[model samples]
Target: MKVMVQPVVRLLLSVPLCVLVACGSGQEPSPKQTLPLLPKDEVLLAADSSKRAMIVEQVLGFELAPVMESVAGKIAYDETVTARISAPVTGRIVSPLPALGSKVNGGDPLVELDSPELGKAKQGYANALADARLAQGAYERAKSLFEHGVLPHKELQEAENALTHARDDVSQGLMHLHNLGVEDEKIDNRYWVRSPIAGVITERHVNPGLEVRPDLAEPLFVVSDLSRLWVYMNVFEKDIGLIHVGTEVSVTVVAYPNEHFPAVVEYIDKLVDEQTRSIRVRCRILNAQGQLLPAMFASVDVRSGPENKAVVIPLTALFTEGEGDQVFVKLGDGHYKQREVKVRLRMKDRAVIAEGLEAGETIVTEGALLLRTEEANEQSEIDAP
Candidate 1:
């Protein structure tokens, strides 16, 4: 009886002793026992009261905004207002040519040329005028003689025919001079090369004493009205159906990144480029202040169709992760989840989300980075061995 009672007492004493040894041992706590468990997509910040106060929350909503398609483009001169000024008649440039960028009015003299052809024309005109006067006097005299029976009728008729021929020669010479831009009062060997339209001389191709002709391949000057410009864009074939002749467009240039110029779609190419599979689009822009320039790189946004309903949020609410964008949404008090969202349109200070978000949901606009940082720290602790 004594032996059985002693063995039971020893077993009871050994159980409490093993429990005390395990509790008193110096060992690190297991992460599963110490760290708070959270859903893979969710994070909790209730432990940090300061972090909760730093976060800003907002509800998503929709707005009416024009649907737009963005494409790369470049600035070009408006062809209607551009002109290549060339000499109308073949001659040497005698007058001082206007300096490049000189503003000129219609008929403004760009060059004065001394041409041998002009001189000969002037001489011929003078000779023809003299002959016409003499012939007219002779015809009048002959008519009077024929009527008074002083001259034969056949001789008077011959004089009248000669007068008609002389008059024709005179008129032909005068027409030639007029075609050469020679004024009747200023008939001379010198011909002034004048601008046909009012604009600034954008290019100069001739110098004083340089011979120029009407058929020269290169122009003597290029005049363009810089008050307006054209932006040329290439649109994908798929987007061509959405564009039209009178759609509104917005343009931006690298030189002026912060500014956007409003424009209108003026032309669309009927043919598609075979290599790029794209269509050419042109937009007319008003540059009353002449701030835009030709050949500058530009970005174009064509306003397509009508406004549509979309989920929109402030731009600040977005955060980038991996190759896509992300945002944080509140699940409950001090609980948030990171979500991947697709941004459709980015405006001045807001963004339109095409996916991964819904209206009336609360998202963290401010202190999003803080939440991300906290999540990273918690992950590190849980992952430590």
Candidate 2:
């Protein structure tokens, strides 16, 4: 998974040039009119742009928690078992092919290899063992005769040398037999290549009578263990700082929206993607029902809580300016300045500021975004978007 960022902006702006009437129109403005219409509570904001209602002042700090209090995520597996069991010796497949997804245990006959090379190796090993045994007997007799001065020392040495060569031949022949898949006890008969793991055969490329060569990529079978899986997701580089190894994670796939699986954060990429600017994260999930499959699209939510109080601005205050985020604050005495602020959390639509704001300051929470939009349009290139 990789992280990506796309900025979203919603703003409206207009200019309102207040006319000084010297309080002569004193019929009095409505309370709603005097207070200004916006979204938040305990807030008052003057529109620097058009008088159209856009911003709202409110008390922030709220969480959108479901009554169930559970996070939804998708399924994932980390360790995937894949192997192409090739013939170690040129051979003919003598066993029927295992069906795809067939379960196998260790030492189970996946298929038997009957090769001319195997028969030759077995015959050679038997002959070498016989020759070595006979040579050993002659060597022992000759050494005894030499010790009794009944035979020449050179003749005895020749017998011993013959025995040594025979022993070497025997050892090499046994190794060749082993390489041909002849277990020591089965060196006398042809045998099968059994499963190396307790898993299912995911692929079978060869069947009975299929002539396979040692030089060929000749795959006989493929196996995989699906008892557990891995789920991966991407986090924005800005959010990566909060994630750590062993963090609890939950995932839910689109195919199974009602079920959420649990997993532990196993790995978080150290580097951010150059194009997406997101960090990759991986979590290992154990399958209790063996339900997850490969390449399934999933949604993962990482729990990042322990909330803290932060300066929040009115949602109405932020106006989309080109591709940037901007907010207007009522600085003082009817003057409002558009400022840059990074939003962190949102409570009841009030955006908690991650940066660019101080505590207890009056910000144009309602209609501020519109005001900023109007300013940017009026100032055009003069103001940063």
Candidate 3:
């Protein structure tokens, strides 16, 4: 009995010791433990607080119709100083074509042509001159005969009439040769096409040995003074009243966007385009550096002048709420309130505030929609059950 009791006691003690050892080994923790909790994102002025920084505000200010009428324009050669040269008569182009971009003075020969039409003109002139000389000598002889009563009055009268007709023919022929660009000293079939204005040859469509005509659809050469250019912009009929001759404007081209070229309204078309319902306005640009090229698309800003001053804001700031125009006015830190405003004129990327806005007031220029969303959310939460 004692031996049995001793064995049971030893088993009981070893079991407790085993339990203690198991607990101590388990203290070395498993690999998949619970991670620490991260702090919550701070609540900004909006639901997505991170986007609150994107909301921008600007103080209202009065400007000369800050909403400039921006329109698409195209750069073109100033017609006042541009020339399109074509063949004066039917001809075949000779050697030595006009160099593209080469500067030329008025009356400078661009290309020489070998023309059969020119030859006929010169021949006709020569024939008329010979007939005139013969007619003059014949009239002198007939007059001498009549004065001596040797020739009949009718015959002398006929001779005088013949001389007059011959002289008239010579005059007409000489005029025709001059029109063909034939010099009196050098009458030939070689016609030299000359430039009528001083300019650089901007374009050339003629090549050696090519036949040219007077009524070619496209000119053979386009000579333009690149130092000055014109910008043609179309203004809507509603805006035409604000623009007129001498109105100052700003111009920008894709190649030089950072530079604002100053220009003035030179001419406004008398009639509005029936299709576009817009009047064409031409502005003169002085491109002394030759940076601007013809046919380049440009942006033109026609200021409203000092007479149309008003508070202006970016178009992004103006939002439609109900039937009225609204904008977000920043009152305090991270707080914006919507205000109904009256828009006098809306233009590209901007608007003129006629009422409900004042100078020096801070208004949201961007991200107004975000503020509106935040406001709607707050109101929704308030009405939640």
Model 1 ranges with Cα > 4 A deviation: 1-69, 149-160, 305-326, 329-352, 355-385
Reference-based lDDT, each prediction: 0.85, 0.66, 0.85
Tens digits of lDDT, candidate 1, 1-385: 4466888999999999999998889688776456577766667886657888889999887654445546889888898989897777778877776788799888888888888878888899999999999999999999999999999999998999999999999999999888877886345778777788888898888877899888999998889999988999999998788779999887888788889798999999999999999999998999998888889888886664456667878788998989989999998888999999999888666787889998889999998889889888777777789
Which predicted model would earn the best TM-score?
1
User: When superposed on Cα atoms, how far off is each prediction in RMSD?
Assistant: 8.8, 20.1, 8.0
Q: Write the per-residue lDDT of candidate 3 for residues 159-274, one digit (tens) a residue.
A: 99999999999999988877766775355778889998999999999889999999999999999999999999999988888778999888898898789898999999999899
lDDT: worst 10-residue window of model 1: 61-70
- Model 2 bad stretches (over 4 Å): 1-83, 184-189, 232-241, 267-282, 305-385
* Candidate 2 per-residue C-alpha lDDT over 294-346 given as tens digits, one digit per residue, 9 for 90 to 100: 66877665554435445545565665665756776665544567667776654
TM-score of each: 0.71, 0.56, 0.70
Model 2: worst 10 consecutive residues (lDDT sum) = 8-17
Clashing residue pairs in candidate 1 are none
TM-score of 3: 0.70
